[model samples]
Target chain A: MTLRKRIIACLDVTDGRVVKGTRFVDLVDAGDPVELAARYADEGADEITILDIGATRDARPALLDLIGRAATALDVPLSVGGGVRSIADAAAFLDAGADKVAVNSAALRDPTLVELLADRLGSQSVVVAIDAARSAPRVWRVRAVAATEETGREAVAWAREAVERGAGELLVTSIDRDGTRSGYDLELTAAIAASVRVPVVASGGAGSVDHVAEVLEAGAAAALLASTLHFDILRIGSLKRALADRGLSVRLPRPAPSAQQVAAWLG
Target chain B: MIAVVDFGSGNTRSVLRALAAVGAEACLVTSPAGIRAAERLVLPGVGAAPSAVEELMARGLWEPVRRWGADGRPLLGLCLGAQLLLDGSDEGDTPGLGLIAGRCRAFPSVADGGPRQVPHIGWNEVRTDSGAFDAYFVHGYWLDADPAAVTGWTDVDGFRFPSLVRSGSMTGTQFHPEKSGPTGRALLSAFAAGALDARVEAATWS
Candidate 1:
C-alpha cells in the first residue's frame, strides 16, 4: 500500500469564520471554521489546513481557540498557518492542538525560521506554504503576504531551499490558478515535487475530481481544495470515490448501510 | 488512567484529544511518579530523537519507561515514541530505550526508478492481523528489525517497512492512530480495552 494521495480541505479563515476568495481577493464568508472543518473530516478529507488569512494583516496570532475547537472535532491531522513569525508562535499553534504549523511570509523573510521551527517542533510538524504565480512560460515565482508581495525567488528553487532548511512538507499554492476553478498548474506542481524530497501538496484551481486526478498523476502527493468544497460544488465523498475508481489510492470512509441492511438490522 | 508521557515534544495535545474522543481516561504524565502510578503507559513523541531522549532523561523518565515495558505492562509508543523504543536511531545519532531489538534508519530515496519523499507524511493503509486499515503517518525513519517482531506493515514507494511492532507487553506504531480517523479511534479503543492479552496470544500462535 503506497502512500495514498491526500485530499486536504483548506479553510481560509478571517477572524473566526471560514471564507473563500478568488485569487486571494474578494472574500466571501462560508461558515464557522470549526463547523466546516468537522463536516470536511466527516466527508473524508484526508487532512485539514486552517490558514488564518487575516492574522498577518491584523498582526494577531492564528486563531488558537478556533484551532483547539477544530482539533477536538477532527480525528485527522490539522495543520495551521499564517502569522507564525517565531518559534514561540509556532509552538503556540502546536500547543493549541495543531499537528503541523505552516509558515509562509515568515519563512520568506527569514529562511532560518524554517530550521528553527523544524528544530523546535520536529520537521514533521513544520510545513512551508509557498504561494506562487507564473513568472515565465514554465517558471513560477514565490508570492508572500496573501499573494500581495512578490519575493522574486523562483518557486522550485524556494521549495528545494525550504526542504533543505528543514520543512517536512511543502504546501505549494498557485496564485494564478487559486480559486479559478480551471484546474491546478500541473507543470508548477510537478516542478516543485520533482525538485524536493518532501511531500508536495498542490493547492489552487481544483474544479473537478478529474483535475485532482490530473495533478496527483503529475506527481503531487496531495491536493488542497478550498472553493469547491466550501461552496458545495463538490462533495468530498464523491470525489474520493471517483479517485478510487480511477485506481488512485484514497482513504474512503466506511460505507453507509443500504436500506435493506438497515431494515434487516432493525428487524 | 492512561498516562501519555509528555517529553516536551510535539502533538501531545492532539493525542490527548484523540484519547478523549475515544472516551479513554487519559492524562499527561510529565514525571517519573506519574509513570509509576499509571494503569497504562502511552509514550507519545514528535521531534528529533536526541531532544526527546534528552527530555525523557531530564524528567527522570528514561529508566521508569524501560522498567515499565520490561515488567510486561501495557505500554504503547506513538511515532517518535515508537522510534525511541528501539536500540537507537540515525536521527540525531540518539540512543533509544532498546526495548525492541532494532535500529531506526531513514527511508531510502530511490525505491524503484522514482524518487520517494522522506517523512512519509500522509494517510496510508496498514496491514495487521485484524485487517487492512488506513492510518496517518509522519516520519522520516522506519524500524529496521526482524519480521517476526513486526505486527503490521505498510508499503510506500515500493518499499515495505514495519508500521506497527509488538514485543511482549510493548507495542508501537509508526503511524499516529490518534490522527487516523475512525479506524485509528477503534484501534485506540481496543488497546484501552485489554486487547494486549489477545495480541500476546496471537503473537505466540503465529
Candidate 2:
C-alpha cells in the first residue's frame, strides 16, 4: 500500500490551556488541550502536534504535564514544539511522552542543535519547524520567534540545511496565509517540499478540505490543522473521507474492535 | 506477566501505556533477573540499532534476551527491536541478535519510484493475508528476510518490505503497534492472550 498522507491536529497551548488567535494575537481559550487531543485521535488524526506558544522557563513544568497527559491519551504519534531550545529541554519533552520534538528559533540560532538532537534522540524524533513569510512573488524568507522577527535566511536554503543537519521532517508554516482562511501558501510549501528530501508537513491557513487537498497535491506529506479543527470548522473523519474520495491515500478511521474479533485476529 | 524490556532507551513508557490500554499486565524489565521472572517478552526500541544493541549489552541483557529467543518463548520485537532480531544492520555496521535469517538494509535514496526520503516516516498500511491495517512507522532501515518468514508487508517509496515477520514463537513488526491506534491495541491484546503462541503450536502439530 502507498504511504498514507498524514493529517496532524495542532494545539497551540499557553498556560496549560489550548488557545488560538488570528496572526498570534488576541488569544482566546479553545478548551482543555488534553481533551481536544484525545478527541482528534478518536477522529483519526494520523499525528498530533502540540506547540507551547507560551513556552517559558517558568511554564516548563505545566507544559510537560500537559504533554504527558496528552501523550497518555493518544495512541498515535505525538510531536511537541515551541520554546524547545536545548538538548535538556527536548529530552524533558521526550521523557514526558512526546514522540518527537520540533525546533524552530533555537535551531536557526544554532544549527548544530538539530544535529545534537538527532544524535541523542534519533533523526526521526527531530522536526525543524520553519515559519516563512512571502518576501517576493516567488521568494520566502524564514521568520523566527513565532513570526515576530525576520531571520534573513531563505526558506528553501534553510530547509536543505536543516535536513543535512539531520532533521527527519520539516514543519513549514506560512506566515502570510496564517489565520487568513485563504489556503496554504502553495508556492512556499511546494518550494520547501521540493528542496528537502524528508517529509514536509504544511501548516497554517487550513480553512477548508480543498485547501488541505491543494497542499497535499503540492507535495506535502501531511497537513497541520489548528483553527479549522479546534473551532469545529471542519471534522477530521469527513475531511479524510473527502480526501479519500479525491483519490489521495489517507488513513480512514477503523472501527473499534470487539473482544471476539481480537481473539480471531490472534487465531 | 509480560515483560517489556527496557534498556535505558526507547519509548518504554508508551509501550507500557499501550499494554495497559489493552489490559495487558506488563512491566519494564531492565535486567536478566526481570527477564527471568517474566512469562513473555516484548522488545520495543527506537533510534539507531548499534546504540540499542550497545545499551542492551551495557545493561547485561544481551545474552539473556538471545537465550530467551533461542529457548522459543514468545518474543515480540518492535521497530529497531525487530531490526535487532536480524543478523546485522547497515546502520552503524551493527551486529544483531541473529534470531532471524536476514540483515537490516537501508532504503535507497533513489528507487524506481524516483527520489524518496531515507527515513520512511508516517502511517502506512500493513497488508496481511487476512486484511490490511494502517500502522504508524518511522525507520531508516528495513528487514530483508526469507519470504516464508514474512507474515505482513508494506510498500514505501518504490519497494515492498516485511512489516511483520514470524519465526517459530518469535514475532517482529517494523511498525510501532503501540502507536498505531486500534490495530496496535488489538495486536497487544492478542499477544497478552497468548493467541500468537497458539498459532505456532498448531502449525507445528499440523
Candidate 3:
C-alpha cells in the first residue's frame, strides 16, 4: 500500500505544437501535443503536464482546443500551466478538461493566487511551478518570466511559502540542469522536498532511467522528463521497467519486452 | 442513468469520461431535482469541505442527497465527496451530510522525523479485502471512520487509514478511481453494474 514514485511526461507547447529547448530557450518543434500526450499515457506515464510556454509572452490564453484533445485521449490526470494569471484563466483550463492548473510567474507575482485557485478549485488541483537556478553553491533562486528574471527569493523558502499558501504540489524545475540532460539537481530537489510537506515533482534534467530513479530516491515524489522522452531517446515503458528492476516502485502497463526478447520472438 | 453530482467542486468531466469508458451512462447533475431523478447517484468532489457543503446547501441538494441515502439508493462518493459523507471534517470546521459515521482528520506528521509530505499526491496501492490495486490519491486529510464501516485501507509513510468505506447502500473511496487507469475503470464498471442490479432486485421484490 505504499505510494509509487511517478513519472510525469512534460509537453512544453507553443502555438499548439510541442516544443523543447535548452535552458528554456532555442525552442524547437517536438510534435503534436495531443498525440505525444496520448502516446505517453499509453506507455504508462503516471501523469502529463502540458505547459503553454508561449501564452504569457504572446499575451494569449492556453490552447484550450489542444488541452481538450489531450484530455479526451488520455485517462491519467492532465495538469496545464502557463498564462494562468487569474481565476478565470485557471477555470478555462479546468473547463477544457485539465485535472489541475499550474501557475508559475503569476504565483510569484502574487502568492494569493495559489490560495485563490485552491479555494475555488480545491488545493489538489493547484500546482505551483517554481523555476530555479543556482544562485550560489547549494543556493537556488527562483526564476520567473521563462527563467529570464531572478526573483531573489530562495527556492526552498518560496516552495514552503507556496505550500502554505494552498499549493497542493510543487513542480520544482532546476534551470541550470534543464535541457542540459546532466540529470536533475538532486540537492536542490531534495532540499525543497524536505522543506515542504506537499508532494514535489522534480523537473528539468532527465537523461536516462537511472537519473529518474536517482531523483525519486533523493526525495522527489515524481520526476518530469522532456527532451529524452520527446526525442525517443528513452521509452516510458523501458524506463519504468528499469526503475522497477532497481527496486523502486513504479507502475508499468505490463512487463516491457527486452530488445533481445523481441529479437528472439521475431526470429 | 448515473448522475455525478456537481456543486462547484472538482472535475466531473474526467469522472464522466471514466464512467463512460466503463459503459455507464453517467452525466453531471447540479440540482436537487436532478439528484432525485437519477437512477443512481455519485457524489464526486475535490474542494474544501465547508465550501462543498455550502454549495450543496445553496443548490438545495443537501436534503435530497441525504434522502437518497436514507432511501437505500446506490450512492458512491469520491475523495471530498467521500469526506462529505462523514459527520464533519477538521479541514474547514464543516458539518457534513452525516451519511457515514466518521470525521476527516489531517494526516499526522511523519513519526520518524523523515520528510513525509501532506497532500499525499500520487499513485498509491490500495488494499481491499478482495486484493490489492493501485489508485490515484491527492488529499491532505484522511478519514477517521468507525472500524466497522471501513472496507479498505491504504498505508502512507507507516500511517494506516481508511481508503474505502461502505454503509448500507453508500460506498466511498478516498482515491480517484476515474484516474487510476484500467484498474480504476474496472472498479467503476463493477460498482455501476452491481449497484444497478441491486436496485433492480430491490424494485422487483418491492
Better of 1 and 3 by TM-score: 1
Please provide the root mean square deviation of candidate 2 (C-alpha atoms, Å): 2.0
| Per-model CA lDDT versus the true structure | 0.86, 0.89, 0.84
Measured with C-alpha atoms, the lDDT of residue B130 in candidate 2 is 67
TM-scores for the candidates? 0.90, 0.95, 0.88
Alpha-carbon runs more than 4 Å astray in model 2 = A258-267, B111-115, B199-206
lDDT of 2 by residue, B1-206 (tens): 99999987667899999998888999999889999999999999988888889999999999999999988899999998899899899999999899998999987657455226668888998877767778999888888977877888888766888888888778898999899988888888877887667343455775
Instruction: Show model 3 residue runs off by greater than 4 Å.
Output: A56-62, A254-267, B90-93, B109-115, B195-206
Q: Write the per-residue lDDT of candidate 3 for residues A1-267, one digit (tens) a residue.
A: 368989999999988789999999998999999899989988989999999988854435348878877887777899999989999999988988898999999989998899999888878889999999997898999989999987889998899999999998899999999898889999999999889877799999999887899999999989999989999988999999999999998876743233333222112
Error of 1 at B8 (Å): 1.7
- DockQ, per model, reads 0.33, 0.57, 0.25
Ten-residue region with minimum lDDT total, candidate 2 chain A: A258-267
Clashes of 2: 0
- The digit string of per-residue lDDT tens for model 1 on B5-44 reads 9887676777888889878999999888999999998999
Instruction: Estimate how well candidate 2 is docked, as a DockQ score.
Output: 0.57
| Candidate 1 residue lDDT tens string, A1-267 | 688889999999987888899999999999989999999998999999999989854535438888888999998999999888999889888878888899999899999999998887779889999999998899998989999998889999899999999999999999999999999999999998888877899999999989999999999989999999999989999999999999998989864333333222112
Worst 10 residues of 3 chain B by lDDT: B194-203
lDDT of 1 at B174: 92
